[model samples]
Target: MDNLQKCPQIVDILPTAEGQVRPMTKLEPQEQHEVWLRAVELAGGKVPTGRIVKDVVQKIMERTKVPNTYQIGEVCQILVKDNPELRGKGGCWGIVSAVNEFSCTLRMWDGEYTIGLQHLKSYNYLPAECEQMQVICDACGGLRLRINRVYSSGLEESVQKFLESLGKLNRASLTALEEKLLKVLESEIRD
Candidate 1:
């Protein structure tokens, strides 16, 4: 690994699916070694990253344990604590329409999203509450055709907090809040 040379910058070399190619140009030999060392520590394995024959990423993924607790039609909020790209969707509720090894297909108010298991937080709600949320979820699923935009900074954060609050409401409180939320959504559609 120490003797590895920096590759050329020109289209460099395209890797074939059947062949073994290394990303020598992506990092210096020493830097590559450090990255591999870190990966080994993170994966708790002795796989060398400098070699192309080793499936380092696959091995790491195989060792990852994301519990499958999501169920179809269940209401859950999207968790986006560490995913900055998903900030706009933080705390957004969705219906789990499908479940896989490490993720779920969610039907949201704006659209459908395939979310990782770690990005889900289940909530226990009444049947009426589920019905109410389903309406919002459908609206959101269709909003992609109308609004077709991501939530902005202040709006995203506030929306997350607002939805979070809704989950904590009692039956009486939920009725009023759900009505208000539906009214707001309905109003938005008219304009």
Candidate 2:
């Protein structure tokens, strides 16, 4: 028996789906030598004798075509048709600050904010003409104000807070009136 048959490191040559017999593991020294001789014979003696034959795993990376929907630094126009805060604020413009697979960062006149893909309309040219010209706030005595600017700034917040406070006051007054009515009913019942 040969030393290759006695060694525990013997590798089996298996036929792959491609019909090629591939060595799957480390071989004994004698088996390695035998493989070299067989490889040289297969190569028609073109390879030098005693040279080792090794099988290396090569990875082939394929270039896939990925669809690009949007990108950072791309200027896009905002579609505010469904946004209540943006209603009547047409012609307000914005710039794309950052981009990702799902959303993009938008820098508007108010400040930098993030918006979804559905919220964007199309790529816009920089220096786009503001469609809605600045209008004087008739309520504030004709002070020039951008519509979106007014909606996003402290003016809106202050107004909302004031309304909320008024609502609480109204609720308290109603509760007090209900208690007075209950007291009057109790006094009449006693008589």
Candidate 3:
């Protein structure tokens, strides 16, 4: 005997559409993933064929949407939750240079790096923190600053190793080093 709750009729649950899926170019990767999971659940957990999954996901993508949460000019931290490649690169700050469908390009002191949407989180910076970054950028020829990316640079290589901790700090938990580093950098720029 089939369980009524477990095997509910998919037809009744799913809206009847005109058999078309709109462009998914606008759907965020996370949204597309959710749509794919819903499609599988709709198929009774048998893992429907790839073609069916894709079609259903596309169809759902037409109805559902998720907006980009990260914005340009906002500071963001690289999260290594799922991407092992970023294992030791957490707590680093970067300026958002560009935003794409499922990723963003961040300009760092050395260069620009692109990270997928899943590997990013917003960094809450204090007013002073922002101005400090701008100061570093201005002094460095508007180039990216490496103060927060200490993970990439050995502590011994840091002009002031203490600055590396700033990246790990949030607006509410800023450290004195954050301010000191800005002051030091600004002074060095004057010379």
**Candidate maximizing TM-score:** 1
- By TM-score rank, best first, the candidates go 1, 3, 2
Give the alpha carbon lDDT tens digit for every residue of 76-122 in model 3.
77876534666546767676779986678976544678987656887
Off by over 4 Å in 2: 1-68, 85-89, 124-191
TM-score to native of every candidate shown: 0.45, 0.30, 0.42
Candidate 1: stretches off by over 4 Å: 1-66, 139-144, 149-191
How much is the lDDT of residue 181 in candidate 3?
66
Error of 1 at 124 (Å): 2.1
Candidate 2 per-residue lDDT, tens place, 68-179, comes to 3765555566665334555433443455667765467765444566775545765443442222111111122211122223333434455434322322221113256544
The local distance difference test score of each candidate is 0.54, 0.40, 0.56
Query: Lowest summed lDDT over 10 consecutive residues: which window, candidate 1?
Result: 3-12
Per-residue lDDT for 74-151 in model 1, tens only? 888888844465666776777888998878998764457898665688887776877777666554443333233322
Candidate 3 whole-model C-alpha lDDT, 0 to 1 = 0.56
> Model 3: which ten-residue window has the lowest total lDDT?
15-24
- Screening candidate 1 with a backbone cut-off below 3 angstroms (N, C-alpha, C), the clashing residue pairs are 109-140, 109-141, 110-140, 110-141, 111-141
